[model samples]
Target: MKAYLDLLQDVYDNGVGKDDRTGTGTRSVFGRQLRCNLSEGFPLLTTKKVFLRGIIHELLWFVRGDTNIKYLVDNNVGIWNEWPFQNYLNAQDLGNLEKHSCEWEERLDAFVIRIQKDQDFAAKWGELGPVYGKQWRNFSGIDQLDWVINEIKQNPTSRRLIVSAWNPAEIEEMAKAGLPPCHTLFQFYVSHDNKLSCQLYQRSADLFLGVPFNIASYALLTMMVAQVCDLELGDFVHTYGDVHIYNNHENQVLEQLSRAPKSLPTMSINPNVKSLFDFTFEDFELLNYQPESAIKAPVAV
Candidate 1:
């Protein structure tokens, strides 16, 4: 976790401030890499308590190719609530807005309630378009996840074991993808000793609020793949492009960095789950996750 802390400090010290798609500005840097050896520990952050439930749900959601947030919402995972809610708010006419004097905070609450209670509303508003899940499981009618898993098993040494979430065609049509994939692509490598290693190429990283979740999500993914393939856990290499800390989250970042990293936790998966797609939320568990405390920060939707 020191590597993650170093990244925060590095960005604050050496990064250049820049405007982003979200109005919140950022201190940005390009082309940085962080690696964690899985054998050492699970590599979950020890400085601040990460919401492991949300991380697990999001990864499972991606594996299922679920482009909707209804599953996440039902399971109490709200990490993705902002994007669809913003879209819904943008659709309302200004005349109606002025007449009602819309309270966005209240409407946001109602948005979740409606999604939970109304099936039609959930279908219409819960969808996140072709985000990670859609891209991972079915990219242009191809099952990339299944293909990659098979490649790892049959041809472990093949350099082509990759899953790409960045669909240029979908990005061009912005309506399909509300937001482009940030963790764009990931590649898997099998060493001679049958240890599985993964390297992720993230095009844009939200260092404060999102990077921690990204690291755990991909690390879990790597472990799951390795488990099904019957290989030893190796390194998780996280490479980034345009990693940045949002202006609003600077204080939280520093506060988190101030704390000393505790011992890394260990994660275990149900041995019965031999296939990657067969994993349910119950199949994964984090052990010894004592951390400092949760740091609160506003997300830049």
Candidate 2:
């Protein structure tokens, strides 16, 4: 949680203003990194209560190779909602126009329509369009998921259990559709002492609106991966490329930083669930979570 606070402080103190696609403008910085120790506690942001349940389920959905928003919607997780909503917005207004040519007014109209008619909207824009799931599960003739699992079991000390979401071909397709992968790539390293560490390299990050969810999601992923590989959890290191705070979210970020973090929460996993895929949402437990309040921030998509 302190890591999150520190990140906000850094952006507020030194970020430079920049024009962005959303027209909300942004205060942005180049490179920054945050580290959290799983052994210390779950890194769910305590200043403003982060939706831990949603984070866990979303990570699980990603690992399960699901690209549809059905699972996320069913679980009440709204992290991925903005992307598809924005996409749907772009689709309705642009109507197959050359990808990046949609006018801002049309995009806003699309957003309005999407929130009103979710099912139809999802049918059109819900697909992540060969984003993270496709890349992680099947990466250009290389099955990263299978490779990581097998490598973890066979050579648990290897540093090659990596999953990348930035597929060049897919990126071309998404760019044609007027979108690009944000949390672009991730790598996992294992120490000889059997400690599993994960580093996520995000090529684009919306700091105020997205980083909290990103932190919780990846930290949970690290914990789950460690459990499956039968190794101790190490650090969850997040590296960002273009981290920005949207103009509308500046006050919210400051409000969150003003609140002090509560005691760290403990996440308990079912011991009997030996395999990663065998565990369900019910098998996970959260204990001693006390947070101030939910700080609402609009997504800049």
Best by TM-score: 1
Candidate 1 error regions (>4 Å): 94-102, 174-177
Q: Distance from true position, residue 193, model 1, in Å?
A: 0.3
Name the lDDT value of residue 36 in candidate 1: 96
Whole-model lDDT for model 2 versus the true structure?
Answer: 0.77
User: At residue 163, what lDDT does model 1 achieve?
Assistant: 95
Candidate 1 lDDT over residue span 47-163, tens digit each: 998999999999999999998889999999998987788778777642133212347667878989999999998999888888888889889999999999999999999999999
Compute the lDDT of residue 273 as modeled in candidate 1: 91
Residue 231's lDDT within candidate 1 is: 97
Instruction: Show the lowest summed lDDT stretch of 10 residues, model 1.
Output: 93-102
What is the per-residue lDDT of model 2 for residues 128-171, given as tens digits with 9 covering 90 to 100?
66766767787788878778877888977666677788887778
Task: Give the deviation of candidate 2 from the true structure as CA RMSD.
Answer: 4.4
Local distance difference test scores for all models: 0.89, 0.77
Candidate 2's error at 268, in angstroms?
0.8
Q: Note the residue pairs that clash in candidate 1.
A: none
